[model samples]
Every structure is written in C-alpha cells, then in structure tokens.
Target: MGRGYRRVHLEPAGAQHICANRPGARPSFGQTGVESSAMSRIRLAASLVGLLLGAACVPPPGDALEERIAEDPTLLRIVDRGELRVGIPTEALGIGADPATPGREASLTTDVAGWIADALGVEPSFRFGTTAEILESIHGGDLDLAFPLMPMTEGAVRSTKRSYTAPYYVAHQRLLLAPDTTGIDDVGKVCLFGDARTQVPVENISPGLEGIRSNDGQGCARMAASGVVDAISAPDLLLYELEASLPGSRLLEPSYNTEGYGAVVQYGETGLAGFVDAVIARAIDDGRWNEAFEARIASLTELAAEPPDLTAEEAGALFPRGLPLE
Candidate 1:
C-alpha cells in the first residue's frame, strides 16, 4: 500500500517594535527652537526605542519550539512549520467519539494518537471527522495520517492506498451492563444496546452487526447511565473507557469477542507504516503498552469489586481454544 504525509504549518510569531522617537522630531535640524531639556527627552526616547527594538529582534529562546519539533521524527515536517495535524473520527464504534472530556473524545483512535505522539516526543494534535471523511482526507492529501478504529475488512484494506501497521490492540464486540443487572447472561440481549425489540441472539450476531450506530460508545454509556439499556456491546478497551466515563456501568464478566486494531497511514506510505510499527513495537517491548493497559484496567477494576461471572467454558469460548492472550 502507498500513502503520503504532510508537514504542519505554523504561523509566524507576532512582534511589535516600540519606537521612542517623537512624532516629528528631527535630530539633523538645528536645535534653535528645541530646548536642551527637549533634546534630552528625544535622546532618551531614541535610546529606549533602540533598546526595545534590540530586545524584540533577539530570536525567541533559541527557537525552542521548532527545535523540539525537529527532534521528533513524526513531527519534523509539522514542527518545521509549527503544527501537527492528525485525522480522527467525529464519531466511531467504540474507538473514537466526540467525548465530553476536554482534549479526549472517548475512542481507541485517540489512544493510538497519544501513542504516536509519545513516539514522536511531541503532543498529539487531533482533527475530527467521520471515518469516511478521515480516510478521504488522508487519501486526498489533506491529512498526514488517520487514527480511526477502522476494521480491516478486505474491501476496506484494498480500496484505500493507505498502509496499516501491525495490530496494536485487539478489539472485539463485548457486552457491557449496569453493575446490578441480572438473569440475562446469555450474551444475546446483553449485546444489543439499541432498540429492545431488535435484540438479536448471540450466535446470530456477526461482524456486520458491529457497525457504528447513532448511539456511539459515549451515547451508549450515557444510555446505560440513564437506564435506557441494561447493557451494550463494543470493543473491550473502549468499553473500559466508557465504563470509566459512565458511573455504575461495567463490562460483563467475559467479553463478547475480539477484533484487531491497527494504525492507518496515507495510501502508499509503506515507509511511514514501518516507522509506526517500529515505534509500537518499542512501546510494547519497553513495557509502556502494558503500563497503559494496566492503568486503565485498574481504574475499571476499582469501580466495582465483584469478579466477572464468566465460567471456564465462557472464557474459553471468547478466545481461540487455548490462546494465552485471552
């Protein structure tokens, strides 16, 4: 696959020069009318003006901002101009949302962006759009990269020139519920977060069923909070984020299933894909990935002390027969 990356553009810093010269003073003209005191005032004003100009002309702190941007591989192009632009979804399944929280709109894509920023040693800058919009922006050369929790469908992978990195997180539809909900452990009604009448059976729920609905993760979490639905189904990590957002909400003891999550680069950007993968690999190897996961999971665990009610069979069924990652 192929993709393109763009540099961020920064506006020039604004500056003002303070001139001390009087409105119509002329140093060359004979001081016939001007008194000595007046001449002293003009000289003082001129000196002050020169001092101000010199101070203003001094470059700002060795161009620290630009220097920091330059040190980051992912932000070199952006920092050179002083801004970083990354694409994210306006709303997505459980991966991205227009979050109520400042700076973060509940989504996996945000987490991925944070990781990318850490790798680049710069703060992440997020640009929100729909999944199609984000992908289109990247493909159209308007965005350097995208971080939507896009599923790796064959058609999706083939249709875009964008390259993908190795899976960073596994995401699969999972059931979420009120901490006190009971008697509905079959995972059928538990998975459906929308209309109660359209509830589908667990076996009947396919990957297609996991499409992005109007009630996104936050909306679903809000619904759970408002007692609209007893449960919801979404990516495990996203469910965790939502649980954190919605009080009294919790993930069912066992997850519904698992899906893979990867980074999105502009079409044909093989080199950037490799670069991103290397950064992710390093994060995984350096224990940063586990640290981030455990921190989020720990918060979720503390919210409720009851252990998930998954039976051995249920746990096994959620993953491959004997997958250790399960």
Candidate 2:
C-alpha cells in the first residue's frame, strides 16, 4: 500500500500593486486649463482609486501569520508554503458530494476547509482520494488538513498517530432494502464496496447478515433497485441521495449506528487542531452549520415519517460549541 497521498495543484496568493502619479500641469504650449486646486483633487482621486483597487487583491497578513508560525511551527510551515493541502474522498455524499466540476466543490467539507484556510491565511488545495489515503496523508504531513474518514467523538476511537478536531457532523450506518428480493431472508443480502476501506468497517459493524461486496455504491444500489440484493448499507445521506434511482425501496426504520465526522490533523500539532476546532465552533455558533443542512440535506425531511429537525445537533457533533480538540 502507498504510505502517503499524492500532491495536487497549489493555489497561489492573489498579489496586487498600487500606483499613482500626480497629474502634472505643463507650463509651455498653451495655458494650463487645470488650476492647482483641480490638480490636487485629481491627484487625490487617483490616490483613492489606486488604494481601493489594490485593496481588492490584498491577501491576508503575511507577517502576522508568519509570527504565529514562529509560535506554532506547524501553522507557520503551512502558511509560509501558502497553501493547505486537503485530502478528500470523492465517494462520500452529503459530506463530500461526488460528480463534481473541474476545480471546486460545494459541500460542508469544502465550506469547512475554506473557513479554516481563511483563518490560516492560506488557500485550500484539494486532493481527491479515498478515506484511508486521506488519513495516511494527514499522518505523514502530505496534507495540512484533511476530512479523514474517521469519526471524531461518537463511536470513534482516537488514533495513536493522528490528532483530531471537534467533529462537525455525525453520519450513521443506514440500511436500504429493495421491495422484493430473490435471496433467502435468513441473512439479508447486504451489498458492500469491494474496497476493504469501505467493506471492512461495514462488515465489522453489521455482523451475521451476509454481505455481497462489490466495487461501488452505485452497483450496490442498482442491485437493491433490481431486487438482486436484500439491502445495501452506507451512509444514510448517501442512501437518500441514491433513492431517486431506487423506486419502492425503503430505508430501514432505525439507523444501525452513528459515526461522527471531522477534520484530522497530524498528532502533536495541537495548535493546528485548536485552530481547526475554533473555525467549526464559529460556524455552529453563527448558525451557518444549521443553515447549511437545511439547504443541502433538505431531502432528509421527506425520507422520514416526520419532518427532520434541523436545529438540533443530531449528528453527534462537538455540541453546544464544539467537540474537544485532542
């Protein structure tokens, strides 16, 4: 197995310059129509225009950030490098939507990364990879911050090698079953991705039921839709996203287990972890996190008998303010 993740593109800081010259009044040829007062006003206007235009392109404070870097070597190293390498899993839905465009993505993970990147005064450069790869990257310093597939608090055991910020949301292991299946009900025909990263965990959590491990979620969902398998288990949010393709299919009444999710940093980089937790804290405090679920995961409302509660912290997040950073 690869020991670390591969590097991707780097986003450079937006640099800008301001230049202004006083409008000179010529003494030759003809009479200078413009008076000294007019020239002064013109100069003032030019100065203001330059100031505003230059301000538009200014990046965050380099020196102050550098000073903090001195205090926290991890932060300084990342800031001085000018970009925060982010490892993301493309297979994750709701948390990290796949079927993305060329450069950027719109999701809670990207939004979270963007927030922390701003606070750190660095651009977040994303690398698309698997959950295992992201965790390896975080441990090896190939990534500055990562949406490590590992859950933070709820149902999460601390890793010996990686440090974690407070969890941002909780995702549960949900079961989606087909209307009619050809197999025996003695053991539900559970579908899983062939990759061990996806299979091992689901298998460990859901024992006894026989699993039909495959290559991807779409295949598993397809099996369920055609009644080829009795059930397919994945993140509830992912199953909900795939529901449109599976008619008459149903989500199992109760979630099997809840797993928290959050960014994971390298171990002993307490400063970076604290900074990451602080960003999540501000988002939840200001209602952006709550507002985000309403906008993105609104379909979750229709999936249940009653309307889903967006106000409550149902995701096993670092509650009230945030999850502890360790």
Number of clashes recorded per candidate: 18, 2
The digit string of per-residue lDDT tens for model 2 on 1-326 reads 24233333222111111112311110121121233344443443333233323434232333132233335656655554556788776645545633345423445576667656655545667776678877767777778777855544422324457766666665556667675643234336788653233223545645667778766778887787676778777756566656545776666655655555667777777788776765566556545566556544544435432222221123334222333433
lDDT values, one for every candidate = 0.46, 0.54
Clashing pairs in 2: 194-214, 318-323
RMSD of each: 16.9, 13.2
TM-score of each: 0.53, 0.59
Candidate 2 at residue 151, lDDT? Answer: 46
- Per-residue lDDT tens digits for candidate 1, residues 45-65, read 343234323433232233232
Q: Number of the top candidate by TM-score?
A: 2
Cα deviation of 23, candidate 1, in Å: 52
